[model samples]
Target chain A: MDQHPTIDTRQTLETPEGTDLSLYPAGFWIRSLAYTLDWLLRIAVVVVAGIVLGASGMGQGLTLVIYFLMEWFYPVIFEVWRGGQTIGKKSLHIKVINDDGTPVTFAGSLIRNLLRVVDFLPGFYVTGIIASLCNRHFKRLGDLAAGTVVVYANSVAASPVLESVGSRPVPDGFNTDEQRFLLAFAQRSSTMSPARQAELAQVLAPAVAPGDPVLAIKQMANHIVGDRTQSAKGHLL
Target chain B: MNLEQLRIAIRPRRDWEAVDLGLRMAQQWWWPMLRVWLIITSPWLVAACVMPPEHQWLVSLCLWWCKPLFERPLLMILSQGVFGVELTTREVLRATPRLFLNQVFLSLTWRRFSFTRSMDLPVIQLEGLHGAERRDRLNVLHRIDSGPASWLTIIGVHVESFLMLACVALLGILIPEEVGAELWTWGFWGESRTGGALLILFAYIAMAVVGPLFVACGFSLYLNRRVKLEGWDIEIAFKRMAQKRGLPTVAILAIAALLQLTPPMLPSAQAQSEREAVKEEILAIKKGPDFHRMETQRVIKSTEKKEEEIDFDKGFWRALIEFLTGAGSLAAAVAGIAELLLWALVLLGIVLLILKYGSWLERFPQLLPHRRRREYRPQTLFGMEVTKESLPDDVSSAALALWQKGEQRPALALLYRASLTSLLTVGVALREGSTELECLRLAERLQQELGIPQTSIRYFSDLTRAWRRLAYGHQAPSDAEGTALCRDWAQYWPEVTRG
Candidate 1:
């Protein structure tokens, strides 16, 4: 794990398995949108339940029960049983999990949900927004107290498709990070301008001097991703 | 502009991640950003505050309309800050006029509502692009990041309002309830000049907080796009590679040698064979579990769903709806069927429970009342009265007489009943409706629990078989078996004989 200070929102958590999991905490805008969606969904559920149950004549007390359950346990049930996501969180590709990168437990979910009252203090979740802004992990009071965090469920950027160029072995003197950047360069080649691509490849001219640097760099990338057959073709050529 | 001095991680990021990176930037440099924002917007806010209550709205509108001017300075500080340049408050203030000079009129007027204003600001200010160049640059940048940039503005507006309302709500909360009620009576919401000014102040505070974040996030989005489009990370890596090797002259020589020593393309047999072998290995690896995995699972799904897109003409819809709503007969019928099925399932569950565990109740007497304390014996066994008073004083002799008179079946039944009555006395707890087989099972258990004579148990078992044959199958026992049962009964239960 590279621990040098950099401005990014990644929260790296080490699991009991001795592996580090990278979690990206969702920011205020996305969280607010999900929260609004969940609020609307809860209201719609309560209203529909009230109307349906009201017509059945056993409504008042049951409706209060529904209100109470939906208010408290709706989030708890969904977070614990539904893979740590409410419907809103699921739709937004975010989920609640233990701070240690484990699935949230029932107690954790309950404590987090129960403390939503505090997060909503002074109305409009002003306290929560402020606290999240202040914290590195964007945790509100409830998340902090419950030892949970809301994180983007899938934060891995899909590798861009690289055009097939003949493969080659990476030359000496490149460290792992630079080697990874070569792969990134090849992956993002589709997005870069042709002139920009040539410019970037020119910087690696010393390492891949015997061949076309652009072709050589992409070949190394293909080899890095386990496509080794083309290297034979390059060898024959 | 030095890649080494760039504060942010230089990897190409997804658009949302770029927005998040902007948030991190804002968080990192919040104080400087906030200071610059508050300083630039202070004069306008003060001007708004000093206005008459009725003119406050106009003043606030102008203050809001000139937000682009205030944001320009914030962006200037951020752009520098991201490159490890921490501008002092004085530097930011001094640079404010120059920052606002480029396209200020257009930014304040027609381009005010441009959703990607923050993102486009960098192109105009930092890159110094204008006219068609600026438009073309925005077009290229907007292809990937415009959605998030626009959403940043949209969400930024909502956050501003929320924070503003929260400021008012905070004030309301701090005041005691009695004072708060009085505040309403004093026109806190409407006409009070202090209240109106206070509203504008809260709105200013909200804008100040959100503005820096909005600008930073948009700037980050723009930077992230450039990173993708130009491979800044790769460039940084190349710079490091260059510095480590320290071989610019060497690289130029190598390029010259490489151009001169180019080998002509010629396919060799060895290379062809190697390619074939590699292809074979690749295919073999592709066939592994990592590539092709088969899994089986069983899932229960509802099978009764119907397609719901039945097209309805006007008259048909009316008639169908009426029929469906004819006192809700359809709904009632569905509910009725569901209720019946549920009730049937419940009843079946109860019956199955008892049938499966019925013997457990007898084995564990505490499950129900033991019923042994009553000491009340049944007067009948298999519908025959078996009381001592109902039997003859000498059961053996009476059975023997009945057998000699050709009443062999009756004689055997009398013997079986008398043995059952004796077994009850010997502590076999039988029910009133126990069959002959039940009596035999209880007697067998009694033989184990109470050290009853094995001979008597065997005799009872033999008598039960004979009696079941005579009673159920209507098959009479032979004279020898009847006489043998009568003879063995006296030995098994001498107490049953009249004393």
Candidate 2:
């Protein structure tokens, strides 16, 4: 059977430990939002520093040096030691990492930061945006040269809250993933319209016959999740 | 409407992730979407250009205001493209009129300013929803993803403007400096009609680029919201499962279950002895070479936190500056010592260079302040002596006499040795253990290096090949061929026989 391969923009890296790490490379708009936030933060700090240092004429050179360092090494310092995230990237739920899924090193961060000048070429980061758009991993020239990528940091998801339904024995022929899918379907049934919920549940009518398929699937999902308190009652039925 | 035909992976995504997926979709289908967009908007751009100079900005505004109308065809292409349906340009154009008719008034008037316009568009156009139904659909979809959809529009606006300015600035950069100065005197934008038209054109170009991308992202966000609400991925999995295992397979499975209920029997005494025998063999296999083995390694990891280099804390910079200001005289003396040390290091570098390659300077006499002549010759190469004393007084006749005595190999070896002795005497440097070919290449190089005649090098080449064939290939030369080499050897190296 020629199955349609599921297409999505995720970069999967294989570790030496024989495990697969899936990383989602963030695209242009969200990254632009992060850049804008970082830009505002930098400008505010510089302006505030200038105001404070302006009272002392000798502090002018020091202020310029401070601005220069902040402009060049702000991202490098934050990314190398701060778990591959700047203040903006942290807030946006994205961070930089080596293409091999390791933590970004100091040299990797420094090279990528320095080459931001090339990525800024032809004015306004047009080249950077185009390069990122052209590649599968959404990598700019800097990311490509440094063998790094900007991937979304994994956010832990809360366990699904299922409704209270009497537990019943699930039918055979479901693998672990399919069993999880059934649980997810039942858990998210609350958000769906009644018609849509029933329509989806009816697809498995052959497996859950002789009853309301929706209620039957929910009961099986409850049993699969190991809530067996209703087992005695379910047997009496 | 067929979920199976849907191209992208149908799964629940975060609001921003949906927008990112849309960006990827736009990049994937950029050419199809962009071609249709250019075909539709290029006419509007032409109209803007043909407009009078004063009203040019208004025409550009109209083109910008009517972007939703132009973007409908782009969405049509994407909506079909996402379902693995690629529409030709003509197909998109034919559908454009029908698309533009839906909610034309509201889209242009009030909805034009909607920050979530991209996300709202699909409900109106694709679902063909209106009035209260549309509002309710938007309400359901906006529960989570409204923030990112709004942000997308905001960022899209800024990016489009930046791209427009960038295009204009890029043109300004490409223009020759003399022409730019001439245009500068005329106040490029304020006085010239060409400048105004160009700005309007570049603005349209920027919109043409971003509009399709904005629509595609909104459509993807809408699709993602529905996938979450309806469990579309789960439903697809169920449909596939039902298709794979229908009623007949279930009956076959029931029969198999019934057959499994009855167990096969064997005589008890015989079965017990057989089972014990099998168990002993299994135990033996378990203790074999391919079975379990264990090893352990020890490693110590650091528990201390790494110190960060740049501290943004306020007091550090102040203290640094104060220390520098306080130690004025001490800083000056340290700086003076550092300057003297830097000069001494440069002098040390020159002295090291002289010690390393002083003989190389003597090779080029004109480059030196005073010449010191030098000559060098190697006594042995490839475990054979190459001095004049090693060869006979008449080298070709000695080889000819050896050849007459049926010693072909020795005759060629003597001629080859005489050639090497003459070349070394002429200062052609051949390294030790150089194969026959390497020595020939060095002798060829001596043609330019030592002004050796072409005939002598050619004779050396012929002699090296004859020697290599006799030594390595074990193929002796013919009688006439060997004699011709001996005859030419004397003419090429007559001085080789003199002590």
Candidate 3:
């Protein structure tokens, strides 16, 4: 087998390879709250209905019917109409996402909610609790069945700023195109290593420096990129 | 459009100094949590004591006629107070009883009023503290900025509270009929009514208690959800928040509501007597004097006095026994004993055979002329003379060659054939219908005809065993063992081949 230097590059890409999917345990309190809220609503509906209609067999039957309806439609109607949330979920600042991290579809929502019975397990969510404890994503039976993920609604970090060419002075020897190239380099400086930055700067030095090479290179980078003072502070070229 | 410009543009324009000043002011009022709770609860405490009987009735009547208006303020006060107080079991019990009463009243009054119509009113405002700002702060405060009480939560709490309180009242009402009237009178209004009226009243109190308890439960659930999602417990831990805040407020509101509602819910004399009888029966279990009870009391007294002495000697002996006789130690001992016995038996057998056979073997030196008197000069069947220094080449190289080529079956066949051929060449006689065992017997005959040393003949038999294993054993021998066997066989082969 021939040893190839490029093999290291391929290895680099594969070595730290992350699966696009990631699972996070749903916090204990959130699930507990959701469950408590679910029970509370179900019980409230039954009791109030029983009381109002009078605690006869008919009243009990009506309460059960109402409960069944609420159970079936509550999550579906609310999640679809209100950007993926039931009242309990909305309060928790959590939303159900698809396996690929997209908004949950109607079908996905239905599948997850419909599996509530299975998630409920022996009684009071014993199976769901065990599953959540064992799994990384804190997925209950419902989440697993539906291939859904519950995540913080706005947890993604904001992107950083990029420097522009129009804000700085051009180097003495560099032409217009070289100035533009330096700006692009500076814009990506934060992500690049110091060594890489120096290497790229050296590559551009000939075009940039006509006299007093270091000074000329510095001036050209400053001219192309804004915030000359910060550049002078050794953050980047 | 770049990040820096966007950041600058989006940065708040408010004066930091003013905001800081406001925060400083707020910080000054950061009283102890207990103080906050006391302040919130002061009004209810005062109401409970100072409010005249007439005023109490009026408030209860008002609650019945206009439940939402009365419920909201009462709940707000109680919940806020409970949230501030450090929770304790006593507080829970105190709160529970009141909630029980309130739930019953709420249930009874709910029939006369239209709950849906009240629900439609602007119970929750969408602006100010109750609005977007309040929502935002609450999100940050409770860690539930996004999730709010859904209609499901509200409805659920109400129903659950109602049912739970009803169950409790039903339990309370199940006391023997004799004491029922007295208990009802003691807890509420003294008037008696029919059995049906009493049942209705009890149900009413259950409803009252259920409502606030449900609300409290819903709030706790909401808080729990936030904690789960955001690790709100970290904040609670940091802030030294107490669990009492969660449970007590609900209990207080529930209890207060129940108390307010209980005045009208007690049963008539007959029903009261039946309920009293049940209560007596339950209490009787604890009240009776028995040997078990005396023993329990004695144990309790002894424990409380700290008079019992530790039996250290007994414990030490048990520990020592456990250490020596544990499963691991016992297994290790068994294995060590078995290994020692096995080696000793093998050594004994070798010594006994050498002593018993040596003299007899010496007498037949001429019959076995290969054996020397001075030292045992082992020899092979071929004309090649053998000594300890010189060994006959006995193994078939052809068999090894076939094995090296990965033809294990063929190699084994070659070995068997070579052994048979060697035996035949040496004038060994065998029956025509003989099996492999018969071939071994023929090899033994050839060994006797050739006057081969017993050790040399034994080596041949061992080789046969190895070949049989290689050909017919289900699992092949381990690599190291097989390699060692091959090396030993190769060393012995030169001597066997010469023989």
Candidate 4:
């Protein structure tokens, strides 16, 4: 069996920085839409309850009691069980993570929703609204208390494609061993800046071609690596 | 393996894979929206269906009157009862006028009120009435509309209007249907048909129309008295003018308590009722030409409108002496003044308590402290400046400091800036202008060039993760675990740079 390289350079090259955590700062309109939708759902729930309970004082009181329980407990239960979302939030393709990029805990979820009173401040959450507007992260008082961030749940690709090196003719200077080394180097350097790659290519060029330099080096690499297959094809060259 | 070798062997993968933590709590607005809709529509629907056809208009009007106060519960009840669904009282309570008032008050107090530049109050005022007369009416209306007095005045007005409407309805119902029809033809809807009902109906109508107006006028007089006693009118007038000029909502609300005394300061009904009968008699006779003619003739024939018959000197002098002898009046005035002072003291105390203590109570600790020193000193290895000793022992405070520092330059960059720039010089490393994402991507490339394992690259991933957490999370990295994680990553920087 062929031995795995001591250092898997290909694997290292393909790795990215951070965990590809793709979060966009949700804009005001999108947030507003979410708020609107949430309100609509709440209203629908209340309306349904009222109809079932009827208009008597006792019925109304019971309905109110039901509403209170749902409002306070629904989110708390969902967030704890499903990692921070009710049905509406899940549907919107968003999730709440703690500031440390972990799932929200029960106490955290409870406190955040409970502190909704403070966020409400003086009236229709004017304080909370202003705080949210001022904050760069789109957090309101509840989020602040909860230590959570709402992020879009979308994934991003991790690697860039490289050029194929199969078409160009081989030159006369370099041997097969040197050409293989250069191709491996070029593949690893796929994500590097063009200027950096060119600078590196300049240093290695003379070793392969001596007098003709760049042209001889390119031809030598082509012949040893079999017609510049991967590099020339622009597949991670 | 050496520590550096181990680091390389164990680095974590850093690809653009998203971790969807799920939707946030505040982002859910469905409850409030649903509550408001149910409030506005349920009562309207119920009132429509339950009331008799003829009474529908009256019921609808009453519902409209109660709409601001009753909408939420009505809707909640309707929705919940019919559909077996429920919502929070907080959601329903959010739609009331009181809630709106509280919000307006807070906003005004916070200095956030701003009226549109194009809003022209005078232009709106002019769309209806005469110049000098309209100006006087508008001034009185503005006075009644602008402050604490305005709310009291509004309540009084609504009460008076309701009473008058009830009386009219009663009288209308009492009149013979045939006579009502006859009077309808003669344009006597305002008088004959309704007026020729029982004398008691007429008397009740007279009392309803005249009594509240007299009381309102008396209250206006008392408003002036209290204004003089407490200097409230000037304060309110200043605030009103400022609000009209587009002062913030907060500032407007801040002036509400200061500009008006609570209901306890107003005149009692007994004191004001002494003058009530005279006002009622005048109003009743003024209702129709027949009554007015008869009353005027009787007054003219009996008193003869004498101009010079009475001697003012004797009457005026006698009244002055009696006023001085009236110790009861002095005591009454003093008692009223004392009561006003007491209320003023109470209100001032409340305001002071709110200002002084409310903020203090808001900062109580969030969670129990974890017994881990490493967690507390996460950034120690980076040699970054963090004044942890000076910070409050609260989690939020520590988190805030760490977050603020990390925001300026992340730990990975700090490591590069300090010692690792040389190692990165030869590979596809991050430059000064590269973004966090770009740096991570470049680090991945460097890992490849150096033959570093995917696990070893996790230092970079962790650094970026901490940086983002500090930057975006509402709470700073407060927990011991979070802080320790930051510190550990800071210490792990040398391994990240090692080829």
**For residues A1-237, could you state the per-residue lDDT of candidate 2 as single tens digits?**
115454577777787888988888888788878877887888888866554443344444556877998899999999999999999999999999998888999999999989989887667777778788888778889999999999889552454687777778778887787777788878888888888777777777777775877878888888998998987765554
Better of 2 and 3 by TM-score: 2
Error of 1 at A177 (Å): 2.7
When sorted by DockQ, best at the front, the candidate numbers are 1, 2, 3, 4
Error of 4 at B486 (Å): 79
For residues B75-136, write the lDDT of model 4, one tens digit per residue.
Answer: 22222221222344333433243333422332334222222100112212112234576456
Instruction: Indicate the worst ten consecutive residues by lDDT in candidate 2 chain B.
Output: B249-258
Clashing pairs in 1: none
Q: Is candidate 1 or candidate 4 better by TM-score?
A: 1
Q: What TM-score between 0 and 1 does chain B of candidate 2 receive?
A: 0.49
Model 4 bad stretches (over 4 Å): A1-29, A55-62, A156-237, B1-499
Best by lDDT: 1
Candidate 2: global Cα-lDDT?
0.75
Query: Chain A: TM-score in each candidate?
Result: 0.91, 0.92, 0.52, 0.54
Candidate 1 C-alpha error for residue A204, in Å: 1.2
Off by over 4 Å in 3: A1-33, A36-237, B1-65, B72-147, B150-153, B156-195, B207-499
TM per model? 0.69, 0.64, 0.24, 0.23
Model 1 DockQ (Cα-based): 0.31
Return whichever of 3 and 4 wins on DockQ.
3
User: For candidate 3, lDDT tens digit of each residue in B1-499?
Assistant: 1111110001111111111111121122223222323322333333322345445444334433443333333233233332232233223323333433433444345433432221211123111123465445445433322123343234434443444444434445575666434333222332222222233333334334333432333333333332233322222221121132222111222113322432222224445554564355434423422112222111112343232223555678788656533346654565455456556777999999979996665444444444242233224322222232332244445555556666666555544444454454444543233556655765677676566556645655765676667666844445443444444553433433555
Indicate the docking level reached by candidate 2.
incorrect
Misplaced by over 4 Å in model 1 are A1-4, A15-18, A232-237, B249-499
What level of docking quality does candidate 3 show? Answer: incorrect
lDDT of 1 by residue, B251-360 (tens): 32211221222222233435556556545545553542224432311222223321122333566888865654333766556545545655677799999999998765
